[model samples]
Target: MATSIFFFVLLFTTVLSRTTPDEASRTKTLDITSSIQKILNPFSVKTFNSFKQEENTVSSSSLLSFQLHSRVAVRGTSHKDYNSLTLARLQRDSTRVKSLQTKVDLVVQGIGKSDLKPMESEFQAEKIEGPIISGTSQGSGEYFSRIGVGHPPSQVYMVLDTGSDVNWIQCAPCADCYQQADPIFEPAASSSYSPLNCNTQQCKSLDVSECRNNTCLYEVSYGDGSYTVGDFVTESITFGGSSSVEKVAIGCGHNNEGLFVGAAGLLGLGGGKLSFPSQINATSFSYCLVDRDSDSTSTLEFNGKTSPDAVTAPLVRNSKLDTFYYLDLTGISVAGNAISVSPLAFKVSDNGDGGVIVDSGTAVTRLQTDVYNTLRDEFVKGTRHLTSTNGVALFDTCYNLKSMKSVEVPTVSFRFSNGKELPLPAKNYLIPVDSSGTFCFAFAPTSSSLSIIGNVQQQGTRVSFDLANSLIGFSPNKC
Candidate 1:
């Protein structure tokens, strides 16, 4: 007990000790004591059909909370455990998809579909309550290829991603040979290795990043006004273990910008993009997500950190975002009470590149105009605590800083395109702040290039970015 407490204290303190103003203050004031107490509470936590009465006010700010995230991968140490080979394949497949997509795009144009592009899937993900989970990799075809099973011959770090859809990194191609933070893909030796060239179908017909010399190269822009350009390559890809060999797209080039953080490139999963090279099954690419703050570490199988009582709903699929799933968020609640707010209506769009992405990059849950007002008004009701600085409203609706009360999971039920409704965990509603911050919304505030759904609200759901179906599916389950 003492040891566990010590570790918790240590981690808690470390989280609070963040140096940056934006991060430091929030962690320090997260009210961890109360949150921990709530976690330890013996009573059964319940789910709410709606939110607190206060969530109704529309956020005065033009900006909605957006979600931006990256995965933390532990690189395999030995050459046998390296993720280098898989890197090659990821790059190769990307090129193939682009060529195929170019042809498809032309077909759509021929059919008079003005903005005709591949279809997509949309879904909602609920936030969980455990430490980040790390599931086992099932090999070439499984979701956890970053953490291969059996014994991997080569290993690499998880592909660092921006919201962009392309994932690639410099491999042996760089003689400087520094151990950049992101893993490198060695295409020279891979059996399935291939590099793009200028004559490729995509390069010849589309305006996308050109595929020259067997390399697909392009620049990606970020909400923060950042971008990266690189070449695409194909190499041997693996998952679970050696037996799970698959093809994947990989980027390789000089990524000097800090945004990529030594990352060669990103694994694209957006609807706007034309490919899913990262997926092993020539059909779909699955990008399994383990919550940043989850507790389970089963590799590919992270039994999320959701409340046990949160009810399960039908898994619905949608064509709105190609292959992504959509959530039926009918209501939100606080402290076990439903807020009197109307549900939101949604219209999906291709964010930026061609990938299935949930917008966790924004600061507040910026719903469509009408939905935004409804949810905001309901979230701020019965405010026992309130504060404002620099003209932002901060509410005390969060759990006790030391009590860990089971804030009734704010149910964000979604009515899928397939007509199924799913009620996700409640923790997705009670966001954590380092300090007494304002009620952070989950949508992007600025009418930026792409609409985003921030991570602050993805607290207890299983979000799957499947490229095979060109869908981003959200499973409303307890974390």
Candidate 2:
């Protein structure tokens, strides 16, 4: 068996001066007194009240909002038909599964005392110019959002990533940068841009930081050999239409190279204090990833309102990997038949090693090898009549769908620790492999102990992360 390469990026620790806000502080009204004066200087109380009313209309309920869209079409030509598209998606998903396994390995290593290194020679030098969008058309699956950054804010599309913590963008005067969809962000053009000092508190919080000519420098390398090396700076970031946050800490990447093809950079949504949500003091955040077939874009909302009917689950916190969001997944059920797996399999260790995580970056769900083998065996037994075919790359179970008009695979449900069951339709598990009617089971086994609930299984569901309450809520088909 080939050694699996994990794809998740584990950020190094930087001490955060800011503390997590309590529930009371979250509900407190925004201080409009200062903002009103800044907006309308030399104005009376009545004038300020009138401007405040206008601000309310222009601003969204959420602190930040974005429309999530599939990156495949953005970087490449659209498939001819639904079958072709499905086949392409399956192939991409297969690649994503392989990368996800590697991510699990990285996560486990970070949790344990193992010294893990990046996969050697995993990336080849590809020369391209301009700001290409984040994510690749071939594989390396990703979902992106467009936001404005800088003083006379320039619009830039960024990958919405919850697994990683550093928010960065490719800046001008690039030494070694990949092609981007948009123009490189010119920090010098923005008057608000200010480089951080080496001794600054924000600079000290980064996992990888050094002093270069008295300026604070940061560098981060991913599992796939992709990396961003640049100066740390603070600038204005605008989200939604009128809502903007000032002096937001961001990585101005002068030398960035990676699989990001259709994006300018990454918008980190992880749990760390340096993440965009945490920096803005967002109470909560939620996202609804739309189905692949849907032409409509999905939504990623910061400090957004959640559905009252959404099922709630406790968000497990592990001090070791504080950047990743941990969830307690008890077991899985196939067509109402519960699989016999050890409860300890789903439990995170005291050192924060083994646990399930909900990741937006990965394409398909992955489980520990033992649990996956049992689940795969049960699935094979349940659907014996279906014509099994040679497995796709990294997917051990595949079927020939030529005989059937529609797939009749068993319904799978993810059982959470709080008794909330997330039922998945057959489409979520049985993925198409080729135009020749080959389909494969989407889930795979990982060598590492960590499990991940990837975006494929999360489609058409409203997933809300309530940092204030330490809870994660899910509403099926809410998109």
Models 1 onward score TM values of 0.52, 0.78
Candidate 2, residue 244: how far the Cα is off, in Å: 1.0
Judging by TM-score against the true structure, name the best candidate.
2
> What is the model-wide C-alpha lDDT for candidate 2?
0.69
- lDDT at position 28, candidate 1: 15
Error of 1 at 60 (Å): 48
* Model 2 stretches with alpha carbons more than 4 Å out: 1-63, 77-141
Cα RMSD, each candidate: 18.6, 17.2
Q: What local distance difference test score does each model get?
A: 0.34, 0.69
Name the candidate that leads on lDDT.
2
lDDT of 1: 0.34
Enumerate clash totals for all models, in the order shown. 184, 20
Q: Which 10-residue span in candidate 1 carries the lowest summed lDDT? A: 135-144
